[model samples]
Target: MLELNFATSMNDAMSDTMIKENPFSSQPTTSAFTEESTYQAVCKSAVASAIFAVLGLSAFLAQMFMLLPILGIVFALLALKAIRAYPDELVGKGAAKFGLLLSAVCLIGSGAMHSFIYATEVPEGYRRISFAELKPSSRGTDAQGFPKRAAELDGEKVFIKGYVRPPSGKQYGLKSFIMVGDFGDCCFGGDPAITDVVAIKIQSDDTVNYGYGLRRIGGTFRLNPSTAASDEEEIPRVFYEIEADHVR
Candidate 1:
């Protein structure tokens, strides 16, 4: 009789426990189902790193865009440090790693490609020079003469970049065209201003098509000796000219 009573009590206790745990009966279940995740919040920096890494692909466009990868690396490092400090609270280790990988690839690849292009850009036997070197001395010269640096380079083979000013006669099948130093001067039509223009006569049978932007020319640099002559009226309209061996 006592054993039967004990068995009945045990059955009642089991039923009570089940009733308390029934979710449909307005009772609490195990903490697993009801509790919110403790570490569900993602590390914000890690997200930012992933985003920046995607944008880092722009590095292929130009050398200046390498900044994107640099920023991605920085953000990724910060995210990893934060996650390490709060492992249980934050997530996104994968995002951080991805950011690191892509950023490194872009930074290194762009740097190498640009370096190669630069090393090979200027053809052999040609020295690169900008318009800055060809300008006349601001401190005043002998009758508005070009700087001494320009005189030294005269008759020497040189490489320079300048805009192809719109030709007055023909756009295509041009044997020669006037080149200007500044983009504004070429597009908006600035005066030739003696020091600002370079007359380019392509040496090869390759006649150039007129276009905008800087033209890369490698050839013999010429200084119109008439500019330095005693008579101001003897000065040529364009003070510099190039018998271009290469035009791009």
Candidate 2:
């Protein structure tokens, strides 16, 4: 009986030890090494940067599209910053770098090309002029409030670049159109400031298609002959008009 009791106690102690060291025990355990999640999310800004970079390829087409690459550069910087701030949770540093590189290339290359064109675009006999030169005189009321610069250039062959203001549901095969220096002034729905607008009449039976990019025109700059007056105000028909001999 004593032997049986001793064996029983020994077995109980062994069972208790086994229970304490059991590998498959149901009790909660703390691992010395915790596993990390392998999945990482791409930064949204990084993705946007890449997308903008792709769209920025169009920057070569026109200067207006240069904004795409500029936005891409901004978004790429933001993405890189976010990825650095959240190292473990966010990825896409490579994508951000790619976006940055492509955007830089597009911006620099297109900018250089546009600058070159701007430098050499005027015809040999045409004088390069800007919209700023056409502003009315601030000091004197001479030339019907026209600036001296504009009056000097009157009937002179001048080369100017401007955006075509879309017409009111009439854009196809146009012989004439309104021009503005700033893109924001384009109004299909409303008229821009009278002084800021130019009436362009295609000469030599030439016609122009509707477009939004800068149009390089070599023309005879002139003041409108019409000084038609409304009941309340005197209004000159367009502040300026271009008798365009060359359009491109």
Candidate 3:
């Protein structure tokens, strides 16, 4: 009878041990190791940092769209929080910090660049000229005439009105040039094409879906005429074109 009692006691002890060892026991699984939480935090930080870095860069390039950096900074702060909470993920933490630093640098650089660009006065040689004053039928009456006019009006800041014409193919669809003169079948008996057009070279992010119509661009007049045939496609000859401080 004593042997039987001993055996029963031993069995009860073993059962209790087994229950404690089981993962499904009452004890919380996450109570022991925090590796899972650390991994999650690291992932979050890395993603946030990458996002901020991209946004900050975008804002810096497009002076008009300056709000991108502000949002980037906000995201960077979130990334910093995640990194601080999970120091075990040192790589992620470092990335987040770097992103924040980059954002700050880009923001400051963008502001400085914008101030410098806008504050600089138009050179006396690059003043604005009125398109109405240009005589299309005169002796200098060629595609190059407008550009010469631009050079003459260099310091005389003026506003020019024109329409945006879409390019031919799908690949060139995004490229639209500003036409200073009329846009019917022909302008002054010349073919109505973008050949003599002033290419606006808008940034990729700028909206280009505005319908073809009269739009005014105001900026310091600058002449960028190209004599080389190969360089013709890249830069237009007559740049009565505005460096566009404002487009209305």
Candidate 4:
């Protein structure tokens, strides 16, 4: 009878030991070692998520890096998964979610901005010209000012990119405005030279928001006779104007 009792006590102790050591057991006796490993993974994930957030925000600096925001979002998602898998041992779930949110925002905002800038594809067959293409010389009506190539573009449907002078009111969809090579030269402070300016007349009811930026304008090009005065000198101003159809 004593031997039987000793054997039973030994079996009970062994069963308890097995239960404590079994990691998958319903009643787990978790150790500091397992928790430490999980915490380390959580830390790594959190740091990765933070890195993603920074990259996503800075992605706007270069058009080629537009995919960075998506990459950041992916990293944040992986971090969240790590946190979820070791909920009892790991932390930073909140951080991971916040990182994901920031990444998504950056991605969407960057996409919208790109669309705004590039949506207007310069229509095919439209002649492209620049202020320098006018070949403006020191004086108006100089042969150099109206090059042969520029004269050929006159009366043709052409596209030009430049800044517009803001009207008196912050108007949208202006019917007419002065187009200039440099905003500071015409509207802000300095007197605008004739060759540096073009008068734009819009035919379509396209509402152009008055602001400062390089905007593409499409219209029928013309050489109009316009003049300006400085110190009682009838300074020759811009001889170019456009019957604008589109301004964006």
Candidate 5:
């Protein structure tokens, strides 16, 4: 009888312990979950706003090129969404508002710069010449087979109209330039037959949408006779050059 009593007591104790360990016995608590969500929202807003602000500044610096300002506007708008989501966070609210302001400044500055560069009359000494006027002797070849047409174009101002072909292979650089005519053979960095095509160097290091259709540009023309080669051999040649004081 004593042994049986002891056994029954042990079984009862075990059952009680199992009941306490059961997860369903306790009520669910969601305080942790709510806190985590709030923290994430605040962080997201702050980060997004900060990024937009930086992009806006970049746009301002490159406003002269018309590319940076446009990008800044886009990033600022995105930041605003994040800020609105986390209104409680001071950083998010500040950053979002700043980004919007920066974007606006970029747009206004870019427009003003464009007007200044393009609207001003070409200087008296700058003559409007054509591609046919370029001397054959001005063309020279570098070690990489890239032509040095600018040497022939020294001290001359010419205006040539052509399609803006983005640098292919290895020719694209930080500066803005384009190919004028369709060259018979497309070289690594340039098209040879379309000698009329020239690269226009923009004053600002701003990124722009170059994949769009052809644009017409006018500027004072000069050339530098130097060969720039990259690891890629088939880099197209950047010959025939124009310096557009303004691009339309």
Candidate 6:
């Protein structure tokens, strides 16, 4: 009887412990919930880093603002730390790796872009001029209404800023192309006025890739009355042309 009582007591204790644990219950434990939250945070960081990396590589958008790549790299590192901390709970390991790669690429690209922009510095003794000032007025537009400053710039070495459009659809190392004042309008297929565009002819046989943002070009300025030829309806062919000596 004593032996049977001891066995019964041990069975009762085991049953009580099992009841408390409640393996059949569907509710998640506090630890499980905490782990899920951690996983989500890790994924969010990874995704954010990836997005920023892509933005950093964007043509003009990232070029003007250098922070995108830096932030992307930072976030990617954070994501990696989180994933390593909770490997069992956190997902998106692949995403974190991809984010890191993209951020690195953008960082490299941004550096190159900065170097290029600095290289295109305007030479001393060149007067700065706007595209609007360079264009002579058409019949519908009055040349007298335009700024007299453009006339003064004629036959002078001038420095101008504009966005480049590759005539050959080449993104890098353009030997010849057109420049426009507004990048937003150009991207949306909006044609700029004749005065707002300039034909750029690079004399160097060594081609340079299209620069991001507003590029400063220094060269000889000439005013001539001629109609521009364009295969695209959105682009006007009539405008002032610049014989570019140096482009940055």
TM-score of each: 0.56, 0.75, 0.43, 0.45, 0.40, 0.53
lDDT measured at residue 129 in model 1 versus the true structure, 0 to 100? 83
lDDT of each residue in 55-129, candidate 4, tens digit only: 787656434566777777777788788777877666787777877888888888878887775555567767778
Please say which candidate is ahead in TM-score: 1 or 4. 1
What lDDT would each prediction earn against the true structure?
A: 0.79, 0.81, 0.54, 0.70, 0.52, 0.70
Full candidate order by lDDT, most accurate first: 2, 1, 6, 4, 3, 5
TM-score order, best first, reads 2, 1, 6, 4, 3, 5
Clashing pairs in 6: 120-248, 173-208, 173-209, 228-237, 228-238
- Which candidate comes out best when scored by lDDT? 2
- For model 3 the TM-score comes to 0.43
Colliding pairs, model 2: none
| Candidate 5 lDDT trough over 10 residues, lowest sum | 227-236
Question: On residues 93-149, what C-alpha lDDT tens digit does candidate 3 reach at each position?
Answer: 566667777777778889998788545533333333345554343435445554344
Q: Candidate 6 at residue 194, lDDT? A: 66
lDDT of 3: 0.54
RMSD of 6: 7.5
Runs of candidate 5 with Cα error greater than 4 angstroms are 1-34, 42-65, 81-91, 125-193, 198-248
lDDT per residue for candidate 1 within 132-220, as digits (tens), equals 77777664444446677777778899998888777765789877877777877777856657676778888998777777645788999
The superposed Cα distance between candidate 4 and the true structure at residue 165, in angstroms, equals 0.9
Q: Write model 2 residue lDDT over 173-208, tens digit each, in one string.
A: 877887788877763444456767778888967777
Task: Show where candidate 2 strays beyond 4 Å.
Answer: 1-39, 81-86, 137-143, 187-190, 228-236
Cα lDDT of model 6 by residue, 1-248, tens digit:
99999999999999988876998968787888887776544478888888887787763344555678788889889988988998866777777788789878877877887678656555888877776666554423335454355556558888888887645455687766778877764454556766777777777564556654567777787655455564334565744667788777
Q: Which ten residues in a row have the lowest lDDT in candidate 3?
A: 227-236
lDDT tens digits, residues 106-131, model 5?
66766776568545534544554455
Off by over 4 Å in 6: 1-14, 17-21, 25-63, 67-120, 132-145, 168-176, 185-190, 203-216, 225-233
Error of 2 at 228 (Å): 7.7
Residue pairs with backbone overlap in model 4: 173-207, 173-208, 194-237, 194-238
| Number of backbone collisions per candidate | 0, 0, 10, 4, 11, 5
> Residue 66 CA error for candidate 3 (Å)?
2.8
